[model samples]
Target: MFVQFFYMLRERGVPVTPTSFLRLQKALSLGVIGSIDDFYTAARSILVKSERYFDTYDQVFAHYFRGATILEMEDVELTDIAKALLEEWLKHPQEMAEALGLDEEQLSRYTPEELIRYFLDRLKEQKEAHHGGNRWIGTGGTSPVGHSGDHPGGMRVGGTSRNKSAVKVAMERRYRDYSQEGPLTEIQMSEALKRLRRMIPHGPRDVVNVDKTIYETMRNGGEISIVFDRRLSDRLKVILMIDNGGWSMDPYIGIVQTLFNYARSQFKDLKIYYFHNTLYSSIWLDPQRHLRPEAIEEFTRRDPETRLIIVGDAAMAPYELTGANAAIYVGQKESRTSEERLKFLARTFRHAVWLNPQPESSWGYTWTIGAIWKIFPMFELTLDGLEKAVQHLMKRH
Candidate 1:
């Protein structure tokens, strides 16, 4: 059985050396392979570290073991394993939950779901913490390099002595005392206000004079006269529509929280809507309620000054993107064709932007993303992209 596992991994392009096989053999000899669960744990300890091997491990494991031993092990189903594995990925959790056929709230309450979400969130938070979403932070004023210190042909120092010196230097640097100031009671709100302020015009004086004047008046007083500024007439209202699932679960919630904070501080009238899929004929204004026949009509009759920002990965079944029944709740009879929906949505708003998490290079391969791109030409996938989108919106306004 151990030799079979080794051969399986080897065939799957995993570099399972003789030393690793020997280590696994010793572990098995120590009576660690009493049950399938024990065998799996031991095998993982011996073979897996970087999860890049997980897909191969899973494929080989499934191909090799197709009996009750693998299937009926401790009530753990394939979905359970998939959830466990994917919790580490920076992908959409809501989509994963849906694909796994698990209820979102119910899974959220479970230990496994909580563990997965927590891990993924922490990973993203750490990535964001490096430079607050800048992505191009310099390391000790060094230019950004394609490779870290680990690449074989990279400019990193070689040999154990050099590595030890580097580690010593890193350790010697005194860690800053973050304890001086306790964690802000409301970091999200604070960050949101800051981001909104950053989006305001900071260009030539003449270009932004009217905007600055209107903003100043609104800042000092409660409101300003729209008649005073001709440019204000062209400025569009903004409606930010966001997804509430997968990796977006936390970030979207944060965005909403930040928007609310901006609304309170700036006193700007902005509308936000939440949806799982793209809006076709209509969207449910109240997420608590299902989509009604009158929803589209109500949205259409709203002020034409509105601009729309739709934030989601647009990842779903291909049919969901183009078929007659693509709308979330509205039946085929009431559903708008994809093109018509896009046109109506664009016409309703002065400008439209789609903020997607998946990078642009991956767009065309995904049916839903491709469909969204066809509709919203300005779809973007990075923090910088989002910041630029905000700038564009403010400039148009």
Candidate 2:
């Protein structure tokens, strides 16, 4: 069972290494785990190292174990009626409450949380999927679990969120899509990239005045202590690689430039480089930003404290991510693969990140996104995503 489980994880792109698998087996053989939940705890702790793999790990674990169900649901249509009509009820929530048989007196009797509990009581009684029904937990009905129905508030188990009264939402796959998809304004991207430049708490030390600190401390009570009076270094040493061209990348050029400009404003020592899809042998530093005669090994020799940031969509033909002479570089004479170059960068840099302008929801559709995500901790080019990625980097250094 463990062998099949391990294979299933690998097949699902979880990247479970053989060493991790061996560790898990040794742990289980020693009876370190005690229960079903314990196995989950032990397996995940040993098998998964990064939070980026959590979604994939969860999927593979649920599929192989079949112990619990993934509660997230896709948008389902209520019977044959258009979803627009059901959505209209959002405008008339009070009428929906009346239509659902809730009286004003009853609303006064319970808090909103109790009302949700009452609805869940009704939901628990449901046994199967229902559509166009007057009762039971289903769609196109008065049931609270399904959408396009007349209810004050429902769990929104399935179907599109037709009303604002979805007091409970299982999981939102659309939120990420909307965030990374088109319609993202410049202001939002600016705000997101602005969070990347954080004041690090520690850096190269300035002069330490021991005599002054001791005098100051003695001047006060014994309770007072000497202050470090440390100053923050605004020095920013970062390298950026932006994806240059392609039809798929046209929509994101503006956003990428916004991040580029914002990062430039933050770090005076920001080394800017350009690569169309991925990096190969080396990166270029020229007046025209062309990949003009420079070696990646030179940049690799830079102080390890330097942070490297890659801004790209990370979307390409699946084959582009695989092969020795991969990546569309300037000269196209490099001998190493894109993955190898990235591995070298990760080893060389103190903190490396890939800020993808593409939506996270779309990542599962392409194979290379997974490849890149494995190479670097990827975050969307959105404000919240940039914040998360920056926070991770800040904690690391």
In terms of lDDT, the best-performing candidate is: 2
Model 2: CA > 4 A from native:
1-230, 286-291, 327-331
- Judged by whole-model lDDT over C-alpha atoms, candidate 2 comes out at 0.61
Considering summed lDDT, which 10 consecutive residues are worst modelled in model 2? 165-174
Candidate achieving the largest TM-score: 2
Please write out the lDDT profile of model 1 over residues 266-329, one tens digit for every residue: 5355666656556655554444334432355466787775657777778766666667666545
Candidate 1's displacement at residue 286, Å, is 2.2
Q: Candidate 1 lDDT (Cα, whole model)?
A: 0.52
**Pairing residues by index, what is the TM-score of model 2?**
0.47
RMSD of 2: 20.7
How far off is residue 112 in model 2, in Å? 55
* Candidate 1 Cα errors over 4 Å, as ranges: 1-170, 173-236, 245-267, 289-294, 328-333, 394-397
